[model samples]
Target: MAVDLEPLDQALETAHLPALSAALVHLTGETSWLRPEWRPTYTPLSRGETGVPEAEQAKMRAAAKAAITAYLTGKAPMAAIPSPEVLHQMMNFVAGADIPEGYGDFLTDELAIDGHSTKDPNWSTPELKAAARKLNVLVVGAGMSGLLAAIRLTQAGVPFEIVDKNPDVGGTWLENTYPGCRVDSSNHIYSYSFEPNHFWPQHFSTQPVLLDYFRGVAGRYDLKKKVRFETVVEEMAWDEARSVWKVRLKTPSGIEHVEANAVITAVGQLNRPRFPDIKGRESFRGPSFHSAEWRHDVDLTGKRVAVIGTGASAFQFVPEIVGKVASLSVFQRTPPWGFPVPHYHEDVPEGMNWLMEHVPFYDKWYRFWMFWMVTDGLLPMVTADPDWTGPTTAVSQLNLGFREMIAAAIAAQAPDRPDLVAKIIPTYPPGGKRALLDNGVWLDALKRDNVELVTDAISEVTASGIVTADGQARDFDVIIYGTGFHASKFLWPMKIKGRQGADLHETWAGDPRAYLGMTTPGFPNLFMIYGPNTNIVVNGSIVFFSECSVRYILGCLKLLAQTGAAAMEPKREVHDAFNIRVDEGNRLMAWGAPQVTSWYKNEAGRVTQNWPFALVDYWRATLAPDPKDFILTKSAELVE
Candidate 1:
């Protein structure tokens, strides 16, 4: 084989040495490479820095160089796949944690260790294929989850159509086009497990790159041809007689009705932007718009701007626009907790990308390292310890450590500005709300000469300016509302009626509950993608959650096919029991604290938006649908 040894050796210089060490173990069966002194030390911030000393890193790199050369020259043979016990130990060593359980099989499939998808549908027989093909399904919102649903459905030979109000594939990525809009999660694991992109420009890619990734995936899978662009689902009702869902759609031309055997709602939790209802909000005279609906036509150069709500969106965009705006005043409802991440906005180095693109198993092992880090890495820090009678600002001893990390980051960023630091630090415990990825740029933006971080409550917005409770009025040419989304209102504004003429909205009463964040008691033959309580507070990407939820939905469909059942819904008792356990579990989570106010909780104070369990638990529950948990029935035609 023809290979350039010089470039390969050079590339190893920039490689993540621990991930490379793990990959070497998988390749050459060299357990000695994973020495105790070379193991990584766990830290949520600055994840790229494995605590392996400089001497150990150099030794690891030298060993990798020799192994790769031998393998390329046909002198060394790849090892047979390791047993479960060995695999589990290797993962624990690479992750720098002794994860109590074995998720080895899960890691193999999710990370594609063997370089192929093991999660695709297994309905291969002609009979099972026929059963799958006989069904018609409708998918709402052609986003990450919807496109994933389309791919899995197509593999099953099932007939399905996708619809989206926006004329695009990415739901959040397409809509939120504000300056510096990018995914906070690392892009390597934030992507679909089936199709990994080895060449993301940034570790956390910007909106355009992310949108292009989704759009490219949609194109590769031929998903867009099956999707009806500019179409909206207005309402859906279950037809108990036909065992179908009567879905009403409004197309670009006119309104129309369609019927489907099942429906999957992938609209997601963050689509609709929420603007605060400060008095006279509509009275702003300048060009005012929500961050989701960005207006690039209106320039901000030399213009005085008033930004409302310093949430995640503002955290990203404020830094991008602070230099251009003449004067900036930021209104903060509550400060967000952000930890310093050096590569949050940095580009993927060319040599590192070359290593991934060229090295056989290097990218997967690298991704595995990141996935393992976030899988359950931070849960302990944010978990509430009920027996602790300490400060209200922190939930547990571990949580206090995380809080101190953030405090240290703040002090390092702005040592001279004590007054600013006092206003910036959050009073609530860490993980009470969304934790942001900061590189000290957000504080740098806030400390600019023209920028003012206003902590005072807003009194009202007049035709020309905003009035604060402190009796100060600020005038500006533009107002940007970064108040975030209506996250608690899952599946909002859509009219859905289920069995017994059950209204889904009225049934929820603003407190949405589902058996497993997918199916409810009355919603037979319906599945939600990013449904109630499925959002993660301090864990990995939501894409992982979507994959788990879609797998469960498919399991439900396969169950229907095998039993010759027309419909299946979670049993009322089962649904109620599961939710009761969820509430109890959430009561021990930091996000569920009484004083913490966030989008995770509904107006009624129920934790309606977050999953209060381990990442592996969701994976296990959604692996396959249990027959005992649901009520299944045959349709009239099948009953005969």
Candidate 2:
């Protein structure tokens, strides 16, 4: 049955006009919606003048109506939209129209359509399916990566089971339940592309909303049926005799063994928190806990509170608790670069949400805009500046611009506190560390009479208070450690024995390395998602990276099936060469600059955390694993 068009039209009346208009333009390459007989040109506009031609205004308007009508009536498909150049021009026209608050500009450049079609002739779908049917797969960690791996495997008709140490799903989100806990990434881009969410309440979704989304996804996909919760994989040993992974798991009742043809380690980096070892920490009687493990029972009303570490979690929680505490002291290790974000807290308007819910292409376009702004468009600003004048400040011209803007904002907010300004102002280049967003609310909270910003190092924790390095003691009833995670330690607390009894820890020597951050040379039939050097510090969504990793892993599985191979692992030479390239790339970026110190790099000063390229680069690199990169092994029977 054909759907009615009247309701959709009525919905569009109250919808985001600009977004709808852009969709119309994208559907019908007619600038005539604005100026009828006139075709658009790409000439730069002069100062104080509109570039749009006035002569063909009427014809363009008529063309726009015709185009929109065609799209609504099933006369045209979105893929049939005119040439890319013309479509872009139409998008600009739509953006210039009357639009809602958050729909300022149409950003389509950030879309992850790298011109690689899913229906490519090179994709050996049949062979891959055959390979997957013969193997049993084991996935560790029921977080975003693991859940995603299961979904992809299910779609490919592959046999797999997911396991997590936690009682339920939603890994980090399940654990970190602190006040004002939320995601810094925009919600649209933070979600999986296959399962785009249209119901995000805010641009930056809070922790509960994110956790609920993950839960809903699991339920909808029936992933919970295959997941073994509260069960930990104690150790995994490669059985050379059988050519399989013998996994030892410990449940509440007893130990169990499971054998699988392949293993995927999706254990994320942010699961473990690294607490600062303060002298006499154990002696102090005050309540102490990491921010990830927030104790809600401890009442802070009219009580002295001390927050150590100025990382992301601290930034969010400090503002929330400042008003409740009798006195608040925030200890800073190093201040983060505060980026200017205007809509961090603004609620998504009802009208916009309505449009996203009702309009056909509205949500997709919005997600595309977010993808561009937060990922691809922001990459250049993260690179180091070799020609900049100041060595102690921004690394490049673009980085300097961002620094100057942020500094001006800080000065404007804290006009009375020059001392705080000097302390908060970062000496390193912009994007040297994780960039933070503030709506002047954090600064306002700091300016309160009861709040104090402590820049000194902690000498020790006494029975009743904290002692600074200068021998000054300040009393506090509670201490919260926002010291962040054990990020550089890739897959910690897991004992993995690879080929010939090779321990994973001993192989990497406390510095984990993987080829394309997905597979290691000695770890046969083992894969990793979001592993070393795969962290998207500057330009991409973790979801995007995970999807790319899944695609590559699927490709490897397909290759094994085609060749009747029992196991596959990257060659040592391939792994080493990849790491050398990653090292060289990191050295040229701002993270390697001498004046800056960031967690992105480990103690050895090697960037074990971030991918130095644009998200698109990673997408292209991991689109499919190169056959030459791996060492294929056949079963003994086949070899004989």
Candidate 3:
């Protein structure tokens, strides 16, 4: 087949210079593109935007085009996996910074620079296949994490069933049909590491796009057949004797009970929307609904709309509904810090998408760049310095640097409105709460003639409207609660009983702790995907965490297959020790500061929802399961 080298000229022009250069090394098997001038400038809060001059970038692009063209035209050979040292160099070159020491291999595996998902298990042996057949896993939720579990299980020749409360796949994405619900992270990295959608329209894909992506993945894996849609897991009790989970499922028809050797809870933390317990919350006779459950049927056109909370959901939806609403009164408890992302909602350039598809390693390198840029974002923002003294908005000098830079960007959003700026700026630290991606439309929406930013505490809600603490009662025809989710509730409403009739929720007592945010001490053969402390804020996407978790769960199952154990759970000492380390790490993080409050923390004031360490650390820790850290229980069948 004749190749198209002519189009490479134009496509190379739109290429991310750093990713192009790194990819050229693999495409042409040449090291010349790893030059100093080809590297990007390490700018905070920006994807790899090469600060090299246009002339230099052109030279690099020409070089990349030639290299890629050679490979396409059968003149060059794809380079084999580079050495760890070489990968470390590429990491630094692509990131435009010295990646912290001992992260070379971790980042290499995480980036999957060799085009392989590190998490996908291979139970190749007949013995392993027989072992897999013996274990039927029950996966709760057909969302991103659950679908990943289903795919991996299918790949490993393991039998499994997936159940989701929703009618289809895509957990949150399928559920949240708000006006402007979109991902805050870059879509390239936000997606599954195994399934890279080079043709993603937007940098941050909207809900429908994201849902389509997940739905496509589900179809690709033929996972929907294994799924019980519109079915909910009501109660799952562990049978200590049998070493199986007796699951009670509520289907569209009626309740049904089933048993599985293992259960992986992929029902995420943020599914349940947490409505603020204001006085007379139910008194509002107006059509009120949580942002997660957006009322698409109720028209908001030219109606007085009251949006409660200014979190990520509001940040996206308000911009969409502001112009349509007659008046938008945003009730904000604490303002979110908006990170300036010029292309947050912009579509990928046609040429860039072309490069990603045609160029050998361009997509991988580009995805790696996005992953690394926000990889250890919390290291500076969350890690409090002992010697530093700063305002409550900042805990350390590095933290202050991020806060000021983002704050300045946010302030510039409403340059003419001093009053809006005063209300928009958060008093807490930048990492204290979930930061939102803004393309300047958020401020534009807030600065609208009909939009009013209400900072005063909500006193109560009347039959028709909301009452402020300042004795101001505002009427609204529609109330949208963008108030965040019940993130602290690990697995709520559903009943999960561990060994010895121990209740999962009652055991945690509002402070959910899990080893690596997957397995707890008592829940044998029961794993969690987006479990406690697994949520990422500044670091990376939850997909990454879910991938890591699912991988870890596979490793655990592999450990069980080898040990001939009925089930295994993290040792109590190991679980407690690991959580101690996590809590200590969170304590040092900026989010752990006493003054700041957010969904990351529980009612008892413990940081229970976020991973306090770098993304790489979690990746490394979940690579394999440690048998020594687990307590293996011999099943009655195996014992006999």
Model 1 misplaced stretches (Cα beyond 4 Å): 1-3, 114-118, 636-640
1-640 per-residue lDDT for model 1 (tens digits):
5666667867888898777777777779868877899888866766568887899888888888889888777788888776677677778777887866657778777766665554677888888998998999999999999999999999888899999999878988899899999998889889997778988899999999999999999999999999998999999999999999999999999999999999999999999889898999999888999999999999999999999998899999999999999999999989999877877988987778877876677787788777766657778888999997889999999998889988888878898999999988999999999889889899999999999999999999999989999999999899999998988778888899998889999999989999899999888999999999899987479999999888889888999988899999888999999999999988898899988989899998889988888887888888889999988889543322
After superposing candidate 2 on the true structure, give the runs of residues whose Cα lies further than 4 Å from its correct spot. 1-22, 29-128, 387-389, 636-640
Could you tell me every candidate's TM-score relative to the true structure? 0.97, 0.87, 0.97
Model 3 — TM-score against the truth?
0.97
Model 3 residue runs over 4 Å out of place are: 114-117, 636-640
Clashing pairs in 1: none
lDDT of each: 0.87, 0.75, 0.85
* Candidate 3 lDDT for residue 444: 97
Q: Report the C-alpha lDDT of model 3 over 263-360, residue by residue, as the tens digit.
A: 99998888999898899989889899999988889999989999999998999889999888899999988888887788887878878888888877
- Compared to the true structure, candidate 1 yields what TM-score? 0.97
